[model samples]
Target chain A: MRTNLMMTAAAGAILATGMTTAAMADGHATDLTLCWAAWDPANSLIELSKDFEEQSGHTMNFEFVPWTSFADRMLNELNSGGQLCDLMIGDSQWIGGGAENGHYVKLNDFFDANGITMDDFLPATVTGYAEWPKNTPNYYALPAYADVVGWTYRKDWFERPELQVEFMDTYGRALDVPANLAELKDIAEFFQGRDIDGTTVYGAAIYTERGSEGITMGVTNVLYNYGFEYENPDQPYDIDGFVNSAGAVEGLQFYKDLYDVGTPPGSSNWYMGENIDAYRSGQVAMQMNFAFIWPGVEADENVGGGNSGYFPNPAGPAGQFAQLGGQGISVVAYSEKQDAALEYIQWFAQPEVQQRWWDLGGASALRAVVEDPDFATSQPYAQTFLDSMAIVKDFWAEPAYADLLIPMQERMHNFVIAGDGTAQEALDGLVRDWIEVFEDEGKI
Target chain B: MTYSPIDRAAAKTPDGVARRIRGLSDRTIAWIFVAPTIFLLLAVNIFPLIWTIRLSFTNFRVNRPNNAVEWVGLRNYERILTDPDVWNTMQATAHFLIWTITLQVLIGFTLAYLINKKFRGNDLWTTIIVFPMMLSPAVVGNFWTFLYQPQIGLFNYVVAFFTGVDPASFSMIGDVHLAPWAIVIADTWMWTPFVMLICLAGLRSIPDSIYEAAECDRASKWRQFWTITIPMALPFLMLAVLFRGIENFKMFDLVVQLTGGGPGNTTTLTSIDLKREAFEKWRTGYSSAYAVILFVTVFGLASIYVKALNKVKER
Candidate 1:
């Protein structure tokens, strides 16, 4: 009874101490909310924020939503001028919309005042995720995470002696990581319906999700390699020849061929999550997915470690480039706690913290962090990541980016999956749609 | 108006709060009690509808609120009316609506008829049949994506097991020709039970004396079913059809989760397209116009349908 009384007393003291600490935090600390997609990196950010909270006497509230609904939820928050999110790790595509509409606070002054130079980050990321008018140095947000669409293949399956011999005999080449779009197509076909260890596997699992930006994101990787520009640099919105170029049509057709003949059954309408699931389940021989998926793939028991091979997107006829996939960190303009938000950004930019962030599974956009000599050997797929980031391009970041995106998504999906028309016809329709949207926006 | 005796007595009562409460007439008290509901209706429903209609007249993009909201009267409506893609979505919505309703009505009424008869384990079977409707449509759509997986999904495996065909030979959601039907099948599966329940209610409500009189007239069971049972259940079945019709007309989540309006624009229903324009594209004015068009279509059709339904009831 005496011991029980002592224990009760200790518990009461602990509870009192907790309440006192919380009350102190509530009084002294500024509560700031940071919003981003609920991906693996968000957990790393959560773990990394403890130091920020402890040092700055500020509480970090996080609003991590699923990738599917992240844009809708966050954009609605920004559009309505809600103060719920003080900071947002917005999609790279949103830079134009976020910047132009005053949804995001201009970060040029913050970077200047805080000694955060744009040159410290990778050029591709700054251009893709931060800049609004394409090549302009007008800073809006700091490139928070740098990523690119790359391929992960079954290295074990490719290295099998009998399989290699069969592939060599059939295609007159040894099976290896594809160096071009044609070779990738061939490899995908070779593994399309083949059995490995008595388990039936499909070719590659590529993105074909129609409702949003999935198919467009996936197809742009190939389209960029085939020299498909959004529009002519000299003549904007004069996209008839540029968007529906012979090479672009061929590239689109190639993608459709791969999807129509190579991918697994019921693989239509797949996006990031489905691609990861397919790879992890050993249902597909290859997966064309964003670098965000690499960590999870690398850790999966069936497909991770030395079992998989990583490579940047293969070159097409014109050139090679991977579609950029990343986000920028910006302070919301309406945020009452903008000062605290800037402070968090400044803390996040420190080299040591970036290094620790990388350690905690974040793909930092800092050149200093990513270009370290040891960074290449830090993880198995790190070298491929570095190479892929070397040749990265982004989609239209126009403030009216969605208006530009949705029609293309529809046209591409209609042609590629639905077989509604020829690739040329689809691109023709897309150009018409894009021209109308641009006219509506009074951009052209 | 003269006060009632009760109100006069309460107004003279000693308690102040009680006197105040009792001083109100029935109509005033009713208004006071329902004021919150009225406010909420105005806030959530009436105001948005008005705002949506107002926005439908302008060239305003939701994402670009700072930009000038141009007065382009009827332009937005004119564009939406002429847009081929919008019409395609309408056709898809209509196709989904007709097929799902037909299948649901047929299957639902059949199930209801079977269950209306005495059975050893009728309650258990009814509960099992109704289980799918209780699930969240999003969750059901997601799991159906798995179940429709050609390689590893149970749906194809079951089909293969019964048909002696490879599971990978055909893709339900991936095939353009099959995707619309896939959505139809899923909607039918989830909502047939709702129709069945309505039908069951209809069957149970049919006065047994009529059947007894039919028996007295030496009418066969089949003849009585054709003449008496169906005629009695017709109103309930029609009610179920109207509810399902409206719901399926705005079908977004399940079909979206299942096919994402894909295998191309084959399944791109109007709601998904409107959502894409409004939220995804942030073409607020254009989408508002689209919304107004859809509202008019559904409202007009429903009004006509209700009038017909009332006529049936009167008959």
Candidate 2:
């Protein structure tokens, strides 16, 4: 009798789970809106989503804001529990807030019900984009794009025999792709203020923008490789020595040095757009930007078609690492059309659809697409994208990421761009700021 | 007998309506008509002010509804007062206010004086001079950024032509020292015409007969100018200052579009800093305290200035 009772209870639980899953799978056509930054990839996604709309019978609406205001605008919409965006391709750092604040619909059950396994996606993207308490199986979003900070150099300039000879003579080595940050600096210095084709050109265009995340993203590419850990590996939020380590200071100092000696005049407030402009206009020999701009660089009339070459962020003394730049698509919790939203996500997860997304210029985070043998040869920057994504690190994804990020942006801009203080002092101040934030959050 | 329209309409009214109308007082009818405007004032202006004051005393984040709000009392106020960074922001704001006001007053008064003297095509020149002021601040900020661009900008080229410094050497918006002045220059360009117009009105309002009487007394042109011109325009000039003082205190879009308060915090005015705190960082409670402090400062200063202006008017 007890055995029968146990079996009946199990059967009832199964039936209840099925009913819940069935409730969201209600066959209905509805309008679904996806929010993301206005960029090349946004246009690509709009094109790619048409297939999903056709297949799922749900209308796809897009709300794309420029990168400058994207974070402020979308975060406001999410914070207010606004139902404007049924889906959001939010920044990776927003995962903690989205999951903890319950702005995102937890997608584990949906993934399971639809047989969408996380293993099929890139591990880095899975950890960076999906997991909230991170390294846990609890999922909030599916990785929509794979991006990392990388370098794009003027290949035509570097390949010129006369320039190469002069570079080699000055540096006592053949100027090829930099194997390390130190060598990258050397290359930048070599090209600094050099005349190219009778027009004066400058070195690399690095991110030093003070308004937003530009400097932090640029500095972290150097910081991570120089042993700047966000916190103690064993203890969370204990960032006294780890954040302001000796090597981290060296890295920060190196970045400041690069800015002072290499970058073009008036490049002090340069970000992605400025960097791209500088490179395309032949004002700079190279640019530090996200991998998403690679396709545009490859297609540009002035600097495209084998004139530009790409490379992962060069190694430093401690290790090789690049700053992760990507987003994951999460179903907004307040969305009234959950059934249609889930249907869209379901249709988006198909491998064939993922392949089409990549072909159409959207960076697919699926392993089957990126890991294929032909993927490396897919585009000029494809291999660099993969390699950079391999060595990726992301900023603090704490629920108070904005609080944490604002201080870092200020400190980094102060030290790197403004020549305000020592790198050690900047990093130490950052620790103090971050500690105060965590303390307020009851984390410490 | 012929009746006027009002008399005929009144005669046709029912006894109940006529009685109600007869019973209504002027003050009561006036209030009935004014009630909507008063209600709107309370809703839009007074309510937000009171709400902001209330929020200033608590630790409330609008984004985190689930978190328990603790009354932090004067902690937020204390933080702002003690923060060295906030003081720096204040300093930047003060610098901007002083420089922009001084430049605008000097140049604007000069232009207005020149325009007051009737010249060939004076109206045409005045229209052309006012064109900069008519353009949107956002647009001005954007175009000025290009104008300030090193090596490729007209401003740099012009400066280089005169000074013989390399156009590629120094950046207007990029240099820490120049960035503060860059914003000042742009603001003065956009708003100097506003001041010019006000000063011109003051100049035009001075009676021609007063000057003629001064001439009959054999008063020198310089003496007449200081005694008559300066005193007469003083009130209007102060009024212009008051208007500009309030507007510059909350200057946002123009500077944001130009430098974004950067090249370090060299250009970070208090308004920009407060915005970052309130919206970007979502420190609603802390920012409420900030807003209250700014409001009190502006209100207190303006009150004193207005009193001084009244005294000058009485004189």
Candidate 3:
């Protein structure tokens, strides 16, 4: 009787262990939620995650929101203790605030434990958006995608012999893609009234959105090019001389000139989507946008597919600079599935997986993958983005940076649309605003 | 006196019961009935307002909620008053409000008068006219933006036919000089019907006898309109002005879509500027102060308006 009882107990223990193992094999998480901005690339990320689930035996859920409401929605979710998302592709600007508020996991320890070095990613890609401060080791996120501003123009229009001859004769120079602000202005003026294929096209469409980050992103390229620094080099928060420099004013006037002479009427409200539409419909000659639109522009029947060409922003007197705009993959601090989330990041970072991401028309932050000849050869615009990445710069990423940016956006819109004040007046206003914010925060 | 004791005792019994019921004062009973509403008001309206007022005194940021909030006293208020940007936005808001209100009242009242005539297809015309207001502001803004497009927009095509300016060369929203007007035009299109509907109700309420009396007096059509129609419609017109004034004062969404308060800042109104300060900038304290200023201004205006409305009613 004792022997029989022992055998039955052993059999029950064995069955229990088998069930636990089966559960473990299924996944640590029953389901996972991922959030990102609404776009074609976001769709591509979702598609890529399907392979992750297939490999790991987990399910993936996604919440994609439009760019306009992206920050507000995420802020609401964080404040309300909404657990709808386990992993989020957050804007780089949110890192400081997110970290301070305990909204995101401090991934430094995780990276250290996993043997991941920051060197694996592009310097600017890691430092610009993902790092809280320049060259800081404390990482709240891993670089998912890197998007920098670049110019897109119609090669067909530029190649027209008659137009080229006319532009050369009028400007006393050959119109081989503008290399500086003066040439850019000249090119815009030349194309302002020109009819192409019986449809009138404007010279350029730069973002000037008021409600969101559109204007800030568009104007920063010019501001930085024209030597507008947010703070004094040594003092950081001191903005007396740098806020409204002569170069900055020149840049602002140039923008005004372009708007006056080149842009189509009623174009003040053009954001990324509108700009893309305008460019795709052959209504505009050039557009300043991110590499995220490469695939769409390439595949699009109207604007892409052998019609669009990409170049870095023209040089300013201060040198060339483009605003780095992209998101980072972050693990939510409140998420229950830390191990699984880490595993997913590890899986995504694999060389083969990164290659697949590039192949699928997604910009990879991985240096090796992005610079791979095989990857570049497959995609037509890969080299254009790769070349443009060298000159990328990013906006302020402080916790109070959003607050600083708000006034800048307001002032920019005011300067550009209202003509209420000069660029100097606007920048000085921004400096004052920033000083007040910093003083209020006791940061200074 | 001894004979009256029995009568007095009998009177006292009924009088005591009456006094006991009356002792539960009407004001006390009224307070009891309204306690729930008062509590709700405190919870929803009063509490938030008090919080906002308190926040306006401190430097609070939404992004860094846990950061130490400092007492800045009236600095926010002082900054706003001194800031030229704030003043410019106010001027823009005023510009938009004046134009939209003027155009809406004139157009709305005219349409209401015509529709109140019981003309053929009056019901259909009223329905069609009010349709713009029925659509969402975002939707209206989007479609209007499309219409304002210089290249393919139908608006520019019509303008081009007359003005001969290359449609591609002028942007109604992009031009700094014209952006405010663009917002005003879009807002007028969307909200004029609301004013018209209110005015139509007022017009319909006027008795036919007034017109008949005016006709017997041999009053001309123009004279009859000036006397009977104008006096009778004043209340509704004021009401429309009050509503539009309050709404346009806080207008954000349509402008956000239409011009986003750009080509630079030509269309940035007080509300858009406030949003930039509050949510976008995360300067909760500064924005709260802005909100309070707006509230005080609107509140004072509304109070005066309500008094004027009462006086009109008395007339």
Measured over all alpha carbons after superposition, the RMSD of each candidate to the real structure, in angstroms, is: 7.3, 5.8, 8.5
Q: Tens digit of lDDT per residue, candidate 1, span A40-157?
A: 8899899998877766668899999998788889999999999999999999999998989999988888888867898988999999888877788788888888889999998998
Per-residue C-alpha lDDT of model 3 across residues B21-55, encoded as one tens digit per residue:
56788898799899999999999999999999999
Runs with alpha carbons beyond 4 Å of true place in candidate 3:
A1-27, A79-81, A171-174, A230-235, A417-421, B1-36, B162-165
lDDT of 2: 0.91
- The number of the candidate with the highest TM-score is 2
TM-score for each candidate, following the candidate numbering = 0.93, 0.95, 0.88
lDDT: worst 10-residue window of model 3 chain B? B1-10
Q: List, for all models, the DockQ compared with the true complex.
A: 0.70, 0.73, 0.51
Give per-residue lDDT, candidate 3, residue A257.
Answer: 70
Error of 1 at A68 (Å): 1.2
Candidates 1 and 2 compared by TM-score, better number = 2
Per-residue alpha-carbon lDDT of model 3 for A1-444, expressed as tens digits?
335335544553454344345446764535778888998788888888887776665678889999989987887787555687788889878877777788888888888886677788888888875677567788888888889888888877888899889987899988777888778878877787678999777788888777778878888788788887877888867777787888888887777677667765566666788788878888788888888888888888887777778777888899888888887888887788766677677667655566667777677888767755555567667777877788887777777667777777777777776576777787778778788778865778
